[model samples]
Target chain A: MATQSFKTYFGRNSRQGLWYVPLLITVVGAVILTVYTDDFASPQNLSNLLSQAMPLIIVAIGQMIVIVIGGMDLSVGAIISLTTALLALDAPAFVLVPAVFAITALIGLVNGYSIVKLNVHPIIATLSVQFIVVGFARILRPVAGGSVPDIVVSCVAGTVFGIPLTVFWAVIVLLLGWKLIHGSRYGLHLFAIGGGVSSGQEDAAHNFGISDQRNVILAYVCSALFAALAGFYIAGRISSGDPGVGETFALDSVTAVAIGGTQLSGGIGSLHGTLFGAILMVLLSNGMNLANLSAFLQGAIKGAILLLVVSLQSRKKMGL
Target chain B: MGAIAANPVLQRAIRVPPAYLVFAVLLITLWVTKPQLMNVNVMGIFIRQVAPLGILVLGQLLVMRVRSIDLSGAGVLLVVNYMISSGIMGDVPAIAYIAMALSVGLAVGLVNGYLVGRRRVSAVIATLAVTVILTGIIQFLASGKPPGDMPGYFNDIYNTKIWIVPTPVAFWLLLTVLMSLFLSRFVFGRFIAAIGENPTASHFSGVPVERTVIASHILASVIASVAALVQSASVAVGSIRLGLEMPIDAVAATILGGVIFGRGDGGVWGPFFGVMCFALLFVVMTSFGVPDPGKQIARGLIILLAAIFYGLSSSEK
Candidate 1:
């Protein structure tokens, strides 16, 4: 957390500077917003910021996993919507929150099956899931429904030492993700599969005693779980099961993962970067909001930022 | 069983694309269950609804043929719709509106082409960014209020009928036929096929791979402009949210037509039928009293089915 550590960490004028772009953005965005308004940069305000960004961070973690596996999921947002709808319709009654998570994992399993077993393109397969899941959500609740259970609400919004419990949830994801990805052979296999995405890297990993398909499937299942959790968080925040809450998450999560310096082409990046990337995205929009920019203009700014960041990162990869 | 599986003629017939089969099934189902629904007047009106999608598929197929995609059609359609309907051009003549609308497509398409083809950006990211930018620009301009109505002349063209078929449907069919013919007869079509088969090999063979990609994007946009005009005219009023579904629908239809990225075994008419399948799906859903959400579910299933079909075909190859 010190500038002294940063000095040795990323030397000036390094070719690998793209890896630090998201971190730089987070710093710059925070500074600019803090300068613009006294409300920003405060501990409470920062806590509020983390709470607001918690769901996307969780969702982006899932996305980051999928990207590490050399694929994408257009359905994560819809999965969130579907799970929330399940909770809205049956929570405190028929379907439990655990059941919602189960259903979401099942959906993710289906997505993985289609891609790995059925040989469907990841984009196409997940897109179909997106549509089906979103449609199912609408069917479950044609309109936003009743509030979530009180326990569910407190579980996310509750505080630990004046910080949102949601922050702890995000931290758990990051910490667990790090161990799962970096500390174990499974992570190594995942990165290997990503390195040879669609080129039979699975076979290579298989020779390494890693069940490639299972890992791919696990990545998807993890993503769906987080998305469903995001739905839980959103349902708590809004106090309703609005099927439309996740309209922006699909692209936004992918954008976060991409900006975090994860290779869209696979075989690069870290959970830490994705975590920072999600914060940067959320902070960018939050800063724009504090600036009192029009909602329309804010959208343009976010879009431009996403486009600019990704292109820059990709350009670096191309040695441009 | 071996003979049945291996018979060349039977195999050829089976390979004639699934969209046609879906169309036939829907038509027969309607004939048996609700003959009254099959009448030209009833079908014509519904078919008109998909004419824009049919046209958009033309462009979708072209770029997709070059191993790239253009989701920016939705963006192009949005900007053109806003321009023609918002009266931003202020009472321009109909032809002038047409020109302006197409120019928007050309402009957006060119940017998409340059980024994807020249700058080597991923087609999905580049085109997706273009859509984001256009949406932002329009949202900024509208500033939260609903846009105004389009000209009466546009609506008149939308609803017009020529000899039992709606004008839009006729236009759609003509475009389909012309595109099919063009792909068969033109040099650019050969270029598209070459680039799609293998960009590096095609380039080494002097196929002008990069230019073909950029040209395909430009052409796709021009075709998308026509679709936008048809769509804007259909709604009659300038609406803020329109044409977002076209990109997905266009991709689905193209895939349903057996036109995977960089491959097109299902010629243009196959996708024309793909468009009709959507039209027919609506009729079937409507007759069954399936609501909007149900229709959405059906659409998703079709896309999934198309993906499954693409997977099967690609692996078989």
Candidate 2:
């Protein structure tokens, strides 16, 4: 029955249906906002939404890659929190940023090592990493007192000719990420790893195949790298590194990735989809604020929309 | 097969659960550094405080074994804590209060089960979404106020001791025993193990895989609600943020207890000891004047160790 329904939908171009639903939801959301608030489509709000979403988009893109390779990086939020705290302690931008990036990469290596050598599931493994990093974050800057250097903040926060600095960073991260995944041999290897690493190389003659173990580690490193970068952006935005600020991003990033149609079970998805999902999420949150919904209600609304999107994605993949 | 038995040295090293050993080492270090810290009377209150988290871990471990998770416990804890203190069930008998709380837990669990089991939703996402909704609903209801003074009677009961042990501790031990018996002696126990090991195979073998998974989740939620009541009763006043860390902490403690995804070795006893380990950790930290942030770091490190232990164990298997 599921196959029959899937075939019927495909016969009518079901792939097109995916785009329509999210688009329709966005349109309806826009309409509702326009009806309710005079500043619904104002230029400032539009820019603010994208700017607010930029960090999450970077993180989501990273998360999307890891998830596609059949793993998760639960420590991204903690990494961001830790990096933000680190950035606050008056270290030079040149030294601090690179140091944080390296530390994050080390964490990713630890995560990858545990997943590959120790054989722990991604959920438990990443969750533990999150705990450790969050704890370290508190230890580093228990409160929101440390101010990121003005120079660094200005760089991240400044506009580039008409484009927001954050937007520019997003574009750079997206292009680099896309090229790595679509342009390089590493990309093909990742697909092979996700497709069943053992079989893909064992059966094929054209194997530029690195071990699945290596891919897993690299994926986690990438996740941490992006998360740390996002942390820098967040520190810029807040002007002060807050220990607890990155707390919500754990759930939000997951929701964004899932909404972008990345299967939680892994082996499928595109960074492009994640980019759209992040935009939609930011817009939705902005729309909710305009609607005068409470912060708590806004969260619930995000989760519900996430549920609908993920379910739709899963169902389509299940050929239902 | 050769790796399993040929390495006698490796086998010896792997015999005992690492967390338990770590707990012992930490305990001894603390005892030596501050001889007065190990006294039962001094440590008892702190142990009692973490009992709520320990109980929540038991439920968390069970769900995790079935290859599922429940972030909704925090939300369930928040709402149930509110219900008990809100005067919503005004002047209800103590037993009735307990019953009402349990029912609320079961209801939330039912919804969670339907989404995860029947609907085939991602367990983490589904439970997380439920948590989001529940958190919102509770916040909307409370208008962001501490719900009410936890009825005085609950505080009295929670604090009471049997012989030397606190009531909550005793209650946890009893529940663990009953849970162990239920899992080991009953058909349901076998079903749970079978389902966790391989859901598809269990289904093929005539087990009601979905039903077992759902039932475990519901049972786990019910246990969490009970923990919330005990937790709320321990506190003098209610707060909106009560039990916010229960889910993650429980996950940590449970993992420490030797229950990793779809496999449990330490069983009830393992998690029971894990809770005791947490209790002792707090005692040690406070005695040494490690400060709050230091304590958080310690807790996180312990959790990380548990994750490492899980990875090591599964790979060996």
Best by lDDT: 1
Candidate 2 DockQ vs. native: 0.46
State the displacement of the C-alpha of residue B97, model 2, in Å, after optimal TM-score superposition.
1.4
DockQ of the candidate models in sequence? 0.50, 0.46
Model 1, B1-317: lDDT tens per residue?
A: 44564667866765667898988998999889998887778888889999999999999999888888888888888888888877888866899988887888888878877777777666777777778778878977987666889899889988889888899998988998899889999998999988877777888999988788888888898899999999999998876663457898998888888787777878788788899998888888899999887877888889888878667545554
Write the residue-wise lDDT of candidate 1 on A1-320 in tens digits. 68766653365532122457788878887888888788787888988888888889889988888987778888999988887778776447335787898899998998998888777878878888898899899998899877677777777777888767877887787787788777788787778887666343446666767788888998888888889888888877776787888978988998888888787767676777788889988887887776688877777777777677666544311100
What TM-score should be assigned to candidate 1?
A: 0.93
Superposed by TM-score, candidate 2 places the C-alpha of residue A94 at a distance from the truth, in angstroms, of 2.1
Estimate TM-scores for all models.
Answer: 0.93, 0.90
Off by over 4 Å in 1: A1-17, A93-95, A161-163, A198-210, A315-320, B1-14
Lowest-lDDT window of 10 residues in candidate 1 chain B? Answer: B1-10
